[model samples]
Target chain A: MTDGDVMRRGDFSNGWKKSFQSLEKWAWRTAVDAAVLLALAAALAAGVNAWKLRGGGSGGLPWAGDWDSYVESKALAAGIGIVTMRELADRVPSAVLDARPRELYRAGHVPGAWPCPAGDVDASLAEHVADLDPAAPVAVYCDGAACADSLEVALELKARGFARVGLYPGGWSEWTANGGAVETGETEAAP
Target chain B: MRRALRIVLLLARLALAGVFLWAAWGKIAAPDAFALAVYRYRILPSWAVNAFALWLPWIEVLAALALLAPGRRWRAAGAALAAGMLAAFTAAYAAALARGLSIACGCFTLRADAAAGGWTTLARNAALFALAAAVFADAFFDRRRRTPSPENP
Candidate 1:
């Protein structure tokens, strides 16, 4: 081989070594940066969530408080049924549930309606229904027709073998707007 | 040619950052609602759901901020993070589809009316995945071309 060709080959080998070394360095640097980014993000999120749960200026997460009373109300009910405000007013023994968070439920709810956050429905429904007959009518509502919590709770009640579960489509907003009897508090006192 | 490629890379980076920032805002605003949405997916266990919801949005925000920062190293790190996040999402969506779960995308909106999970959701995630891949490719593939010359420096 010519002398120039030999030198060119040697140079090519050096170039390959440099490229590989640069790639290795880049990979190492990228990995370290990624670790830092992930740690910072995780720490920030955890801090915010902790603050929120501890009743930060934003008022204790989105909806937190009075879960026990809500569950107790559900347990005390005899049956579940769907009804409008007029129907609810007409039925003497119908058990009412506000299927939003305790905070929203405490703000205003159908008279004698107990808070039942939809998230807790699956876990708490069976115990609540044990106190009631399978055929008793129980009605549940949330924000309004647009909210899905009421429907979800109704389905759970039905699944739990409640014979007469019902969903009040209008929920809290409709009840208040129509001048239906309303109560606001953390207690689940009798209707 | 070089100028055009540089512009393309910059645009891709910005587009990724913008999309992620917009998504992070909604989730961060209503973390409880987002946690419920994540729970509904049934992919992660119940105990993991709230924790995942709490952390995911900040990760998106931080990665987006990094992607927007100048310099190849920062851009590379950001693109990798973005791609990794998209890939995780795509995998989760695919798993949900395979398991026949009816749920919402919960990607951008916390509203109950958010579109139900379906092929459309999968396709949307896949498109984002493609965009993330493009960002990653542009960031890493042209390192030699992007190297500063004495004249440019």
Candidate 2:
């Protein structure tokens, strides 16, 4: 019989009956297989993705790989150098850009550091940059390696046409670790 | 064997429906979290994510309900819809994996903290896909068996 003829004979009600009849035969095995196969596929996919993201290339997305290259190039053009806490202290004349929150900065900071929180860097950097020479080195730091505020502030500086934005990746923890000079009295909070 | 298959089919249907319902409720209740999850994937445009956040849950709920219904056509249609959703989710998950982004999976919520990563999410989706495939396969095979022989014709 033709496909159309078969369907016509069964119609909707009969079709349901037929479908259920087969369900009686293989429901358990089919359900088990379906569940197992799906679970396996999902697990494999999740594992691979997690690895790739943590691998890190300019924010973890593969398509955005060129971002690191861009950041590096900008860093070079801006004469920004990422220095360790010791290196930053050795260069006493440099200005420090504290990228932590205003409250943290007010509580304590590197002796010469200015309170420029990371979130406000893009907006506030212009006024500060206007006062300083673009070629003059500026050091940026936050809490520590676990924190990303410093990197973000550095990127913001780079974007704002400032060429000399140094990132102190070790940040405040490192400064304290290395016995760098710190000022404890409350500093004015950044607006 | 037929009886066993029927039990399996029923279980599969219920499981798939349950997942859809859970996911639908999640997205509907916490759209912002879902939107953020979509944003993290970085696939869809911001505008599209907003629109999807509004509508996707209802579609999922309806499809789940249809799949659980007894009508053959409704079951088939629901299976198709479920399969399509599963396929889309699979592709998105695969892409996210390739990109190496550890994003909160906004499957049920728009909150970043609510996101899950690693194998569990993938396994969950894969299980759903398999259920959809089984439903379709069962329907197809059942129809074939019910057909009369040429000699009878």
Listed in order, each prediction's TM-score against the native is 0.60, 0.49
Q: Residue B124: error of model 1 in Å?
A: 1.9
lDDT value, candidate 1, whole model: 0.69
Model 1 bad stretches (over 4 Å): A1-17, A59-191, B144-153
Residue A49 of model 2: what lDDT? 33
Candidate 1 has a TM-score of: 0.60
* Residues A60-88 of candidate 2: C-alpha lDDT, one tens digit per residue: 12211222233323443455554544456
The per-model DockQ list reads: 0.34, 0.05
True contacts kept of 2: 0.00
- Scored by DockQ, the top model is 1
**Pairs in steric clash, model 1:** A79-A136, A79-A137, A79-A138, A80-A137, A80-A138, A80-A165, A81-A138, A81-A166, A82-A166, A82-A167
The digit string of per-residue lDDT tens for model 1 on B87-129 reads 9988888887887655577888776434465898888888878
True contacts kept of each: 0.31, 0.00
* Candidate 1 residue-wise lDDT, A29-85, digit = tens: 777887889999889887887787787735224323222233212322434433545
Angstrom error of the Cα, residue A70, model 1: value is 14
